[model samples]
Target chain A: MFLPMVLNSLNPLLKETFVNELLKCNERTKDYGLVLTPEGAESIIEARNNILNSLGRVDMGIEVALGLIENFYTSTFINEENYVSVLNEFQEIFYYMKNETEDMISDDKLICIIKDYYENLCGGSLELLKSCLEEFIHDFRRKAHTAEAGLGGEE
Target chain B: MEQRDNSGQTLAVQSKINSTNLKKSQYTIALLNESFRVGLMSREEINNIQIQIMQILKELIARYTKGESSSVCAYTAESILNSILYCIDAYALGCDSPEEAICHLKSLQISKLYERGVKSVSRWLEEARELYKKVRKNKLNVGLESYDHTINEDIPLYFTNCGIVFDAHNGAASIDYQLTFDDMSINGILYMKNYLEHLWIENAFCKYFNSEDIEKLLSDFGRTIGMDYKIELINIFELVFNNAVFAILAGIPEGLRISQYHFDLLSGKLKALDDSEIDKYICQTVEKLVKNMNICELNILDYIYRYKTVFTQRVIRLVRIDSLRGIILTEKEEIKKGYTILFENGKEMKIEDFNLFIKKLMKLKNTEDKIALIKSGIESLNDFVDLLASDCLFGKEFEALFNELGDMELAILAKMALYEEIRSDFRGLRSVISEKKESRVEWHICFVEFLKKSGIDRIESIERLLGEIDYTEISFY
Candidate 1:
């Protein structure tokens, strides 16, 4: 009973859903060997659990994780040999983003910004994607603490 | 009532148990209980009352399970049960006949429980005991208002009774004793309120002493005990008294005993008690008490009289302008001229006109507004003091605001604020900056290099801005 509960309880479901979404991310994405292995899937599940436990239950945990994975999977940076290492990096980035953004940005919105930056601004570098996320979080937090009345999306 | 459904079968509408239904059911039980005791109620009446009460309680419990009244502590299944018991008792005691008792019980308001003697120390605590028993038996996860919710870990802490006896009986052998509850529980607060309220009710303290008399006694005690002559012993006593009452309410068992923390704060060793959980609890509880209590006979001010310092200290701790140690003033005292006032940013300004400076500084509330004033060229020591006390400037914002101000001292101050945020090692940087006291220009250069060594990325840009002395800009002093 506990086994099924843990397996089904948001974390594993999120990991499964994300990996399935990554498989269908794009046509060229499939040729790049960007698929997550069982071990890779397990690590995502562990990281998801850790994030959820620390941040309490967010309204969009699965969507956020899936969004990050799908965005990463579809990127031009996802080479055949770098898939495993990239997946590991994605886990850390996703975890960091969740906390740094303070769960204010919805999964869909955060994904939109990342996809925009990855395709247009940063020219498909994951390192630049991480930098953009850090800058966004810093500015987002600063405005949140100071400009309570002025910020539009927050309300 | 049956109604025909779309599928042509008769549907029976369920009788809902809402707030109105609950009140009506409570009234019915109360009436039945009264009649049953008076031997006017039939056996059927008793059975029906039992079934009705059970149904109402079941609905209340189900609502609790669904998280209703979860945020609020006033009403719960246990509390409602206790309310039913109290109503029954009040009806039984307040009236002679069953008919009269029914009328009396129906008129007894929840807020009037105090007047009805249903919320006295003995009655409320008896209900609490029963509630705790039920909680233990059922292993329910309900929050108890009487218990300290702040305690996360189960450490074995117990109550230590520190009883105080007042010997003010006109030189006669008269004594009044007060007991301490070393535990944090609502019962302790209620007990303290009960004791103090009883004193007011009986005018027990009046026969021997009054407020002024107590003040004189405290002063005598202070002198005999070698307490600081500057410290108002009467104010401390009143504060301690109110604090004791608050502690009881917050389920703090320690009562009103001065914790080592309070002593540390009083002695300038600790700058603020706001960080302390116990202090936070006391302030919150006292605020709640002040808002809720309605005493026509006894003014709360009379009890707390001229003791605003304790509350002020709880608001903002003013440390010494020179040594940066917290000055334990019950209220804000105007500083003398030539005293160097320090900000949290480690910048200090020597005041030329102390009284006027404080008067202006007290008018402002945030650092950003103060910085804005400085930006518009309001050159004064007052603006600097206000900036120090203001809350708006934090971490990166401090760096930005300092950049806009374009003062060398502020640049140094911004570096201090940034270093504080990153928890960077400042030992070597501090020694270098302290030694460069030859000229203001030399010290500024040394600090700029130190900022670069400390990994402040914007040092050169800040240094270039600092070179063009905007005398039109406000000085740090």
Candidate 2:
């Protein structure tokens, strides 16, 4: 609670530095021949809002979540043209997963799971990543259903 | 209470005075307790009100005892309680102050305060609470958004105890607003409150209806309920309320008709209610609902229009009669068998002559007939037009016959025959049929005007060709 207020008061200074640092990093990362750019910040903000609204959550793990987003996009095959849309779709998946798991799975764990799927099983396919997220939600729901049944409860 | 007259003579107070004829104040407190039980008075406020009333009696007694006043007024337990109720209602209706409300209540010419204040106001308040509870907490768990799918967002329905106040989050701008009830106008409060109860009633009615029927009904009313339309929530409530009341009073089994199939359905649902009370409640509720709509400046036209089918169907059910509009469709099926006309020469002509004449006109196979009719002059055409105006033609057949009359003079003559000519014996049927014929004539004239506008001026049998074109197909716009 205190952190957002403190960060909000310092947002103007932080935003200027943050944008400059992002651009500077983009410039250096070009040497490593990655097509990443600093155009996906809007997508991150939208994602943050969707998660916060749907889960009724504060910005506890939002920055780390955003950081995880930036890391995946920079290393993946997403270019400037499709990065915003791809990030938005990912945000939808993340929001849906959080609610489906009843927030039992932390944001860090979700991000880690997505990263592993993206690099290994999915091979950088957004479609495959979505299906993986759906499977995770289905599993979570099944387990919840089983638990309810065991407890003699109806949902 | 004991009092003294101006002459220093002791007087007996009415209301079972004991010993020296002092009136007892016991019934005053008893009335307050009864008011508390009926929910007109809160526990905290009851004692204070009882004391204040007793204080008024005491001051009057003291003035008379000192011989400052000539007379003291007698107040029974019933009369005192009536005044308290009047004050309570007036205050609840947003008086400037309780004192002002009480002062205003005293001036009203209330003959029977027992019926007006205690019984009527208590029932209204009770019904208001039940409706508010049903809308906000809905025991069925069925939401308002169930019937209105255009409400995309899941907004919670809110109600406060201040008398049938329903608050809604209007989808636009996410603003929460209450459809205000004019507390001073009892009908206005009841009108808004009954809407909430009607929502619950509709949910129950839906159980008897097939899913497809509900879909068709909703689609028919889609213009008002659809997303693009932003009807005020109160208007939506009115629409639902009107439909629900009609459904319960007389079930609508088909479009614009109340069939007996669903009457038992409504009766079954209302089986819990006392049979005698049901009819009384229906009359009173319907009367009040209609009265509120009539007296207030509120425009329920959109609501009435959206649910016109059910509204008209219920009215038709209650009156047990088909409207003139229904007769137009009935005429499409067959001709009136006994509709024969007597000429000036006392010769009766059967309707088949007119039918055959129209059929020949349609086939354009009777140039000689037209010549013969012309030779016979205006009298012959008048007879033909009179038969035509009897509304013996279907919409398509009417158009076809009128179009077959290639003369514009003949068409104008047909218009006159339908509107001006009258038959006294079949008065009701003639008026209805004449009105319908007038509408068909207007449509013919409109289509002819369209043809003239489109530079198709010299065509033969324009009405015939226009009749071939569907009503939806012909658009002057």
Q: Which candidate gets the maximum lDDT versus the true structure?
A: 1
DockQ, 0 to 1 scale, candidate 2: 0.00
lDDT tens readout by residue for model 1, A3-60: 2222224343345665665445445456656656556656655565554444332222
Residue A139's C-alpha lDDT in candidate 1?
89
Off-target runs (Cα >4 Å) in candidate 2 are: A1-43, A46-89, A92-116, A131-155, B1-430, B433-477
TM-score of 2: 0.22
Instruction: Name the runs in model 1 displaced over 4 angstroms.
Output: A1-35, A47-63, A70-84, A101-104, A138-155, B1-179, B185-209, B226-477
Question: B421-461 in candidate 1: lDDT tens per residue?
Answer: 21222223334344433433322343344454443435444
- TM-score for each candidate, following the candidate numbering: 0.29, 0.22
Error of 1 at A112 (Å): 2.6
TM-score of chain B of 1: 0.22
Backbone clashes, each candidate: 14, 2
At residue B111, candidate 1 shows an lDDT of: 31
CA lDDT of each prediction against the hidden true structure: 0.41, 0.40
Candidate 1 steric clashes: 14
- What's the distance in Å from true for residue B303, model 2? 22
Which is the leading candidate under DockQ? Answer: 1
